[model samples]
Target: MIRFQHISLMRGTKTLLENADATLNPGEKIGLIGANGAGKSSLFGMLRGELHADQGEIDFPSRWRLAYVAQETPALDRAAIEYAIDGDVHLRHLQQQLAEAESAPATAANGSLIAELHGALADADAYTVRSRAEQLLTGLGFTLDQMQLPVASFSGGWRMRLNLAQALMCPSDLLLLDEPTNHLDLDAIIWLEDWLKRYAGTLIIISHDRDFLDGVVNVILQIDEQKLKRYSGNYSAFERQRAAQLTLAQSMLEKQTRQRAHLQSFIDRFKAKATKARQAQSRIKALAKMEELAPLRAAAEFSFEFRDPVSAPNPLMVLDDVDAGYRIEDSKGTIGKKIVSGINFSLQSGQRIGLLGVNGAGKSTFIKTIAGDLPPLSGKLHTGKGLVIGYFAQHQVEMLWHDESPLWHLVKIAPDTREQELRNFLGSFNFPGNMVTSPIAPFSGGEKARLALALIVWQRPNLLLLDEPTNHLDLETREALTMALAQFEGTLVLVSHDRHLLRATTDQFMIVADGKLQPFDGDLDDYRDWLFKTKLVAKSLNAEPSPPAVSERRNAPADTPVADNSNRREQKRFEAQDRQRISALKKPVETRIKRLEEQLAKRNARKDELDAQLAAPEIYDAANKETLKTLLTEQAYCAKEIEQLEHEWLEQQEALEKIS
Candidate 1:
């Protein structure tokens, strides 16, 4: 439905996409894969038409519906779940129209017309919307009461979920999500994966969540070395295919290198011979025509070197049955709102704990309380004797001065620390030379994040509290951080969405949920399995889940002179049971397939509407333009989804026919 023809996107001196070409078709779930700074997000921005390519063209059908969830979301006052979800002006307008149509008195002249309109509105699912809105909100990890709370009341991470809900709820054909799984916990991530898998609209996602990629996406589109490569199947399958291709490339390169070396050696030995000179010249020309071979080497290595612990166990932070929650200022603290309470947790030496929960589950609040940013509403928190701690907040990017250099900031914070020591420390975190003196203001979000990390490590605190530390980091940086923390030999507590990082860097898992923290015994894999198997909404929404029902066996005949005809009766009974089982299983598949078809139909209609909006001249209005852009993206996504579902429905139908 959308195609990029020799597209090249350059921002000043750097090329983000170099003559990249690809086609996105209906029913294909594409995963945008690359290392950090590989231009995945930039490419998505181009697709959203938020940024223009320096060269070439992006060709796609006009009037496509598109919805995008950006990396950062606007913070809003906590509002009711129902209010926020249905708050979109357009959706609300539809709701009002539907309501008016239903409330209008019907006379004999217009009774049938009004009745027909009412049915259409119902099918639109535009009115009586609170329940549906609540359902989606709850699916995304909000409690019924939590949904009604002002969005401004939520922390940045929770606010992200609200933003995600807006994107998901928006009527669109194509959905573009950038690192959508960041800041979310195992449960929320699993829930999102299922939601996308079952989603009937087209989806293009840039995520580091391996499990999500494996479950939700059917194809992998990799942008490596500024080139686009496509692979069929999910992440694991793509990895295998990529590995094979790389292996073949390596083998060919090696063989060519050996042949070239042998030829050069022969030429070198007889270069002075008059007769051999002509042959040598011919060999050189032949070699020049061959493509330069890439070296065969293992993927990049993640290594770390850190200062050893200087002291023994130093209890950093102490929580004494501390009930903690942020209280909003309500004129002299007379009236307040509590975010989390009854939180009792502590950090001790040599302890590595992974915090777990769904999005907006108070994981960040728990970390912040420990970090000493916001005081506890009730209960006591004590610091250990001579405790030195290092903290990395989820929004650490906000701490950097946009106008000041990293060196200036570091020197200002620690005047006593020598300049040489600071530079060396920063270098350890991969910031070297001009990078240390570069102004933080122009640094990308990821670079700023790394700067923050570098500054924190310089402190060399025995206690470390990290909240979503891996969120903005690329795979390579994340690996480095993981290694650094694993060898720290100090008390480390982390709240992160990267399962591989969590599993590799921490040993224990603690969940801050339902107003408390509980220890989970199993590992990341175990948590993932439990999430998929136990969460009902996640299960129902999973794209690759088994068919809705399993075939059941039928009842066997009971009477017929058992001794005389036992064998025949037994055979008949088995056959009957088998037939009944098949019938039972077929029923649910048909029902599910029908539901999928209905959703696909609605999405197609939405796509058509979005296409028209994109093609309209009225889109020049700023607000109308933004809305149109969103529509275009959603339309592309919807077209892709419709195709995927249709393929799945066809497969299911075939299975049903075979059994029948």
Candidate 2:
């Protein structure tokens, strides 16, 4: 067990943990959660012995081995597998000793040392370290050929995965991982979740991904009000318990407020009266003796809605046998090689789609093609009229001007908008006061991501194309984004490894694989099963073949006729034609439904505006009798028009559904 007793921690003058206490039992998988700058990482530092508590002490087993992912990876001309194997310090030491013994001149002592080292290496299972390291690498989305490549050749994100693999490769009593899934894709995340579930050692993870936490951690430790609070069960359970506590606290506070108010009123009314002065004095003393209840403070609270688009055209874009890929040009300037080919898809207004696949499966390529960052290599790409797209990718965050402030960025995009209005918008994204005007170069990755999203939302786009939008955002910001996306009336197509976000914001999923794109007719769990089955099939194909037994041969079915293949092909072609015909038939109805929805939105917006006008006290004055009458008449008209439009919209929707 690990224990912290009266632990007080401070960085500079800011108190991060004040007299905090907690106990972590052996083999417990703990999740450390808090807002950014809330000292979750600082606590990890203390546990690793790199930092000390300002007061009191932490106690744990003295002999326990600890392993944590390195924050930085140096550019080394060494095989990736070798770097991962180096994580096992004990094995490395044994190998070094064995090498030294083998190098020495022949002698009885040297021979004996060599034999002993060999035995120790065998005991440590050092011979299989390469295979184990490769397994780790594979689970983290590394290819077989890439395992032997130099560490210096990989990109930043790939290098982070290497560091994580190194950490997992280490033999330890306790393992610490901070944001392990940030660089991973959905498949890799699922793989890591399974790996962690099978791990026997104690684990502590600091992550903002709710579903990931829920899947892996058995306990949740939250940093609230400068104290370490422990909760049994996973992240979801913690949320429920915390919500209940907050509700109870709020009720008590309200009760206290009412009691204090009543006592104060009594004293104010009778403090000078001869008969009741004594009772009033007693009440005053009672009121003075009451303890003040502080107002409940949420960790972080801010939300901003996407502006309505100026126009919403049905079928926002269409791809006809398009090839989404990068140009493979040299000095002579050749056209692009196809990463994904024969892509025939349509993006309709009000559609919410999630894209899923393994890493390097052309998900980003498709998104870039749709965002107009890349041109289709071979076919026509039709964009709808008045189409306004808000495209967000990781590189968009990198494109922000480091020297400029959030205010500057907003002003650059909205030059006609007032400064106060821009500032208010930035505040809604948690950039308050000086933070809005200060250079964003000093901001964290989460802050930069929020700024990028804020800029996109201000554009009033009809179609939103987001690729891994939740990468650097913390839990609070992610929740806010999920809420905003849920409420967005425009079209949304998101590619994210965050399952909670995808599940919350998307209604359907499309998969990119084998140089093709297709609809995924299942939820996230089914995707996981599919990934597992795919791996099994790949493994079986790679394995050596074995001869069939006599009984198995007897049970095998006879071969079909050669003509059957042609017949099956014809059947598939006919099915494809039927699907196209149905889609063509549905288009008109879908268009009608979209137009009706747009009209309803406009009318509802106008009705809201009129309702706000009618809420004013001046609208009821006698001097404005004629104005009031006109307002009333218009309000009634709006109500009736809204009713009729809603009915028509519902009918159109039903008609469209029937066609589908």
Candidate 3:
């Protein structure tokens, strides 16, 4: 267990945390949530003893091992996973000692050395060290073949994953994760959630991804106005409860203010009366003693209003067998390898479409092509007459000058747009007063995203093309954007991984698979469901039946008319038998699938328990410690079962397809 008692964190002249108290139990998943630069990362540093607290100590058991991921990049050379895992000098020394002790002859004089070696081995969890390393690497999205590849060859996101993999591989009493899901895709995020669930340690994760938080965390530690507040439950539950508390605070303030006003009125009317003078004086004293109630300021609520799309009778954009890519600039405009080719698609007026594909699958390139940033190779492109499009590219936020404020940017969009009104609008996005005046350069990634979005919406273009619009938005802001898009009567072609946002804003999906764009008549969830049913579930339903007996007696009827009553009756009976068999087989497959899903859920719960236990040094003792080798064997068997279930599910789906 870990607890912060009367902690205060200050950065220069700014107070980031003041008298903040928070308790995190083993197996308790807590989310450290706040706006950008709210000192979430600093809190982790303080807890880990890297940063000194101004006024309090972090209480935890002695000899506790804690791991943390900082928001800033750390210097690391490109190395293989194996090398990285074993690179820690202290751990390597322990491993060497263990190896030496293993080779030494047994003798009474060597007893103490052997005992010391065993303790070191236990501390290192050396019995299943390799398996732990492998699991951590795999969970972080590394394939077996990729484990030995140089980390330098990976992208920034992958490098971050490698860092995360190292943290998980270490046996720590507590895990401090800050925005771990930022660079991960949906699949990788899900895998990490499962891994954390099974981790036998305490974890405090600071994240802006609400979905990820809800899935893994059970508690919320909110930092607001340099104060800390604790709530029991996931992010959603905490939010609901927080809102209720705010409402109550407002009501209490209103009631107290009303009482004060009534007392003032009485004093003003009765103070002149001779008999009521004493009573009035007492009322005055009461008024003096009465505490003034100031309501807690409500959290920001953003409302995005887009300009009405220009009404056009024709489609806004079209691409015909075109190839799109980033071209090297020379005297000539186009010169580069086409990243995506043979793309054929069209965007019509009033079409709300979502672009779905893996990252770097040419979605951005295609959008750039439509925006006229890149010319298509060997194909024609067209835009409807007067098609005013607002495009938000990946680097759209970079266009804002560091010194310019939101109001300044608003003025650029429209010369006469009121500064006060623009400030109010920015305030709705949680940027208020001096924060609005602060240079864009100091803003957090989420704040930058909101500012960029605000600028784009101010343009009021007829066609809105957003790429990963919800990239850095919180749950509330993302929802507000979704609502705005839903109410938007214009063409919206967006790229997003947020399931809720995609479902709420998109009407159709354009799947960019294999360098080709194909329009599907559904949302992201629906597409996922269809893919699962067809590819995973269907395979389970169609197992082969026993081979049919070949006989001359059966062949004799090949040319014969089976329209006779007896022959027809026999054929009907055979058909009914086949139907019954198929139905019976399907029932068990369905049941097995359901059971496997339930088992997965149970495993997740158990994993969470393990995480809590591991996070507590008391729960993790060298004396009563379970053998790492035994745990590894059990974990491996469970992992194998999960893999087999997935494989069998796929095969079952294939069998079902054959039967159909």
Q: How many Å off is the CA of 485 in candidate 1?
A: 2.3
Clashing pairs in 2: none
User: Highest lDDT among the candidates is held by which one?
Assistant: 2
TM-score of each: 0.70, 0.80, 0.70
Residue 361 of model 2 has an lDDT of 84
Backbone clash numbers for all candidates listed: 47, 0, 21
Candidate ranking (lDDT, best to worst): 2, 1, 3
Ranking by TM-score: 2, 3, 1
Identify the candidate with maximal TM-score: 2
Task: Quickly count the clashes in candidate 1.
Answer: 47
> Which candidate, 2 or 3, has the higher lDDT?
2
Q: lDDT at 555 for candidate 3? A: 31
Indicate whether candidate 1 or candidate 2 has the larger TM-score.
2
Q: After superposition, how far is residue 641 of candidate 3 from its true place, in Å?
A: 14
Mind giving the per-residue lDDT tens digits that candidate 2 earns over 1-660?
A: 999899999999999999999999999999999878989999999989999999989999999899999999999999998999989999999999978867778565665566566667656657567767877898898888999999999999999999999898888899999999999999999999999998898999999999999999999999988999999999999999999999999999999999999999999999999999999999999998999999888545767788888999988999999999988769888868889999999888899999988888889999999999999998999999999999997577789999999999999989999999999889988899999999999899999999999999999999999999989899988999999999999999999999999999999988888888888777888788667645533432343212112222122223333368786676566556656755754666566667778888898898899899989999766566546555655666566666666765775566456435
